[model samples]
Target: MGNMSKELLREYIKEQNFTNANDILNGLKEMFRDVLQEALEAEMDEALGYRKYDGIEKTNNNSRNGYSKKTVKTELGPVQVNIPRDRNGEFEPRIVPKYQ
Candidate 1:
């Protein structure tokens, strides 16, 4: 997980204007889903040895193919997340396993 600055958190909460318990829970779920998605993207970048859209330092031919939608069951409920895929089919996500 990454550190979210207080200013950014405050700004996000203000934008949300959470007024009830259910609203707060829903907001948390959204945050969790977003963080998980970002982590998956970062993992792909690391595995492929270059960030997406940057062909400067790319040494291999493997590249980003597309995304596969997977429903992750969390304590909050089921959240739909897009798992990044590589062209060579060697990108196995560790955050949410392919078989999980």
Candidate 2:
């Protein structure tokens, strides 16, 4: 997946004739999922004050906890995302608010 390029994506779309609205929506959903996941991870890093596997000694009591599955409604459709968590449960995400 890391090796996939825009040209390959375009070729796949053309080969599959993904021109219909449903196909476009599905594609957008997938793209949004990837983006949202990355954002959530980044948010976690910022909240924890360290990157994943940074190997730095813990300076604070709060740390990253496992993620929680959440389904959000969007214009594309219902997209499932993994929301990051903190041990102190104080890491509120600004990208997708907890109540939203």
Candidate 3:
């Protein structure tokens, strides 16, 4: 029904000693990291004004054009993402690291 807050979830797990919760969280974290990485890479590719997809680089299939390497700044530090680009000479790489 309603979204469970992080604090609530933490407290519930702590009280129950539910190790499963940690596993689930770890799994989710992995999934999120992968998805986030792909998204950020795509964005970075676009920002770099990429025009085509190169085997050397990770480019989104949705991108019709190519892409270029970009350096993105993040809270953790500098992250490089491959932004997507359009065939119409449009590409904007993002300034974020590609998550695992």
Candidate 4:
């Protein structure tokens, strides 16, 4: 994929029917949330040395346990995200660190 063209962006705005500044801000916030969430998931994949559900034996015992709800501050404001967990409690998310 390539960068979104201005014409495509304008078409998207028209389709969304953004009525005011608030609508645009909300859309940007949602996009930020999605990007951050995807980054976190990719980090987990790297830490685990395999993609989710790959069925390959993990070199170590660590595996994806589940997710923990965490709120992180961003320029858009505080956005909630599901931080993936490892069974041994070692999957520290670099994007949204625990102390942040």
Best-fitting candidate, scored by TM-score: 1
Residue pairs with backbone overlap in model 1: none
TM-score of 4: 0.84
Between 1 and 4, whose TM-score is larger?
A: 1
- Candidate with better TM-score, 1 vs 2: 1
RMSD of 4: 2.4
2 or 4, greater by lDDT: 4
Whole-model Cα lDDT per candidate?
0.93, 0.87, 0.52, 0.88
Ranking by lDDT: 1, 4, 2, 3
* Clashes (candidate 2): 0
- The best candidate by lDDT is 1
Q: Candidate 2 at residue 12, lDDT?
A: 65
The ten-residue window of minimal lDDT in model 4 covers 1-10
Model 2 poorest 10 in a row by lDDT: 10-19
Off by over 4 Å in 4: 5-8
TM-scores of all predicted structures: 0.91, 0.77, 0.34, 0.84
Q: For residue 14, give model 1's deviation from the true position in Å.
A: 0.9
Query: Over the stretch 6-89, how does candidate 4's per-residue lDDT look in tens digits?
Result: 898888788889989999988888878998999999999999898899988878888999999998888888899999999999
Which runs of model 2 end up more than 4 angstroms from their true locations?
1-21
Q: Per-residue lDDT of 1-100 in model 2, one digit per residue for the tens?
A: 4788999978867866786888877876888899899999998899888998999987789988898888989888799999999989999998888898
